[model samples]
Target: MHGPPDARSLNRRAAIKVGVALAGGIPRLGALSTDAPLQEPARLKARPGDPTLKAFAGRQQINTDGAQALAWVPESVKRDVASPLVLFLHGALRRPEIYLEQHISMADETGTIVLAPFSTIGTWDAIRGAFGRDIGVIDASLRWVFERWRIDPRRIVISGFSDGGSYGLSVGVANGDFFTRIVAWSPGFMIPVKTIGKPPVLISHGTEDQILPIDRTSRQIVPALRAAGYTVDYREFKGPHAIQKPILEEMIRELAGRR
Candidate 1:
């Protein structure tokens, strides 16, 4: 049900087509409009009778009012402690559960909470163009998480892979003050509506990324990010267009310590 090679998949072929189409040029962004109201983020509450607080980690389909999201929360820390939260956006056609499992170690190793939400469609809304419903879902999810956990607002990070990576770059940069850090893996591009405070960014790409070739992605993204004056930490791997184990480990390591 996650990502394999479906017809609706945004595979390497899809990446190529999209990248080429966007080659024309990206539009400049200003601040987001104040209209188009979105449903307020839902709050999570623990039942008074509960002996232990809910410590759950799985696929949680949330119907926050009319909004829908797939979030994966790490098991609650013992003694009712707080943990850092990472909002991970999955690559095109990928599922949130798989992304959580891939980085499951963060739960115990760093006492970090992970939340991954699905896009309205197969790929993120910004991938095809500008921001859309997905952004609303993201906002709602963060509000939901904040209601339950004692998250350090200063340590929240927006990160993702591929298409999700690109969207993360766009949104994270636009709302830099909101997200202290932005981690992007093999991102295609960074297009934001408006600029915000400078948030340090971490990026990694494989040398042999045939899909969104390195030259066309991180190579461009890193410098542009730097040109924009963002503190950037970039890494080049000897793998493909995927987030290898070591890359994931490093991401978690830095995130866990960012707070």
Candidate 2:
């Protein structure tokens, strides 16, 4: 589990701040060059396979080529029945095991299957530079789950926290044709490599977040997305760089069309 903000994690956050500073207060979005692997054609090929059998119940490990990944299938989801899928990305210096159960619990309540995949390194590949190795890992995990369960193409979601959240906003938008919705918790900045579709976004940030200040982060991001013609639901709460469970629960329900 994520014990506390360690020195390495803090340094990573500091480096993120430096990057934002270097980019004139707002980190640049989209690919830096055409040659960059921002448009990974192969990684986008995974789609839900025909389910002959039901998905495995409860939490289980998924083979993502040595990269740790996990999936949670609720009992409410059955074979051949279209189920919602969430591809959850983790924060810096963290693993999927730390927060997979949280998503699992939520999945149980929402009847959604959650797939949490750890980055190839400390954080997402796009956060360090451009979308690279991690996209393959994610694609492999998605394929593993998709081959077992019939997923509803309309409810596919990409979500994350901190660095993961930032990457989610970027990648989710870039691959919007695949993901219908995006949930970002305390995201710092986005670096989208061209948006494919206009997927609705749900973003929540803590007012007192020191790691990624709400002022320069979500406050700015929400409007930018809105101005860009993407539907955005932004929520700001009184707290730190942490999630408020009730808000997430409500938003997830809304995303599921439960509310």
Candidate 3:
């Protein structure tokens, strides 16, 4: 809520107000006050639960749409090393907090900033998908994070499992300028939307997935993406509809630029 660590109190309040307004769906900056410069939140290196990611620790920040998120910031960044940002979306009926906890160490291990946003509803737009309000809250939250963190824009990633995975493909492709990579685990389908810069994509689906047949899912989607000239890495695992820990670890390492 507070402006960047050194900003004045007035700036902090003004920034919070501005953020609230933007989160409320006013996409136009002119609507808030074209003349005012919204100060960013101060860099809080660590919070209560995490001695690593201060304000970005375990707490949930609710957006105007009532959507919420949990984030993790790496403990340190090597000299000349630009930290990456990873936003992981959970499957349907899943909590972002769980994803945060599950991947907390991934941040330190990779010197990455991790964010997991929860859908305000039972699931992201239920059956009515296509990067709706959930995407808005995500974009706003990411903007807020950007104000405080010096994340590498070229390494920004949008990844998820199941339905979240499907949405990641749709949104990441649409917002290629912001997200350089998309990792979809057990994705169902992609919402054929206008795509931008050919961001690299990683699609992993279980061969035994009964919920969504692989032949009709990643098998087809990966080829289509490649046909569209997008770099793709497709992996087929023998299992049911689920994300394997080993695959998760591999993906994180890949994103971190580690072999």
Candidate 4:
């Protein structure tokens, strides 16, 4: 069986290499070297195909190892059609179900599917220090969804709010080819491992955000991303550390093909 390696085999090899590197070089202590940053451990392995679960509308709980994960499928969606999907991360000390409930309306309005996965602990592993257990949780949740639904690859997005927003930006940068779009709401900072495909970014920050000040966060991030040749759509509003309803709706409209 001497032939070109399949996508799954290549991805598996990459994962193994990442595992060895993390085990030998990158310590769980979360030390990032200036010359070499830690690569993101999680990778999207599943693709659109025949489903295992019956496609339906509304929320579905897909918890993993006691961690809460949820998906919101739009009403009247069909299994034969590929639907847009969003991988949403939650803020620090937040729950995925609450976050999904707050933003699931956007998915319903635009016929997009929303998947929100909880961090193993208080916050995302990367934000705490280095990428760890949460990576496996996210990847597992995604594989489950991919095995149960037809997702639109072109419309797959990574988005979040506050701490989740920061983590989403970081992960989206590392896996931009898979996540076609990146949306951050009142993000604080980014801990990017490596830049992958160039995906357009949409960031909305509150000018008066006290939790994660706008000046030190998105203000600095947007410029760096632009300098690195990323097309960023940055917006500033007069509010606190929260998602602006109108602004978010507009962004979702653009993503949902309504605009």
Candidate models: Cα lDDT each = 0.67, 0.75, 0.62, 0.71
Error of 4 at 145 (Å): 1.4
In the range 61-142, model 3's lDDT, one tens digit per residue, is: 5453354677777657532345677888776665667666666676778777788887767556622433456766676567
Q: Give the C-alpha lDDT of model 2.
A: 0.75
- Compared with the true structure, the alpha-carbon lDDT of candidate 1 equals 0.67
Query: What order do candidates take by lDDT, descending?
Result: 2, 4, 1, 3
Tens digits of lDDT, candidate 1, 113-221? 7778778888887677666677777776666565555666666788888787888887886676577788997777765446667889989888887667787668877
Count of steric clashes across candidates, in order:
2, 1, 8, 0
Candidate no. 1 TM-score: 0.80
Higher-lDDT candidate among 1 and 4? 4
lDDT of 4 by residue, 116-192 (tens): 98788867887766778877777778877777788778888888887788778877877777888999987766674
Model 3 has a clash total of: 8
Can you tell me which runs of candidate 2 are displaced by over 4 Å?
Answer: 1-9, 12-23, 30-43, 52-55
Ten consecutive residues with minimal summed lDDT in candidate 4?
1-10
Winner of 2 and 4 under lDDT: 2
Provide TM-scores for the models: 0.80, 0.87, 0.71, 0.81
Give the better candidate number (1 or 2) by lDDT. 2
Residue-wise C-alpha lDDT for candidate 2, range 26-88, written one tens digit per residue: 546433223446555323668876865345788878775665688888989888678888888
Model 3: lDDT to the true structure: 0.62
| Shift of residue 179 alpha carbon in model 2, Å | 0.6
Give the clashing pairs for model 3: 3-42, 4-40, 4-41, 4-42, 5-42, 45-54, 46-54, 47-54
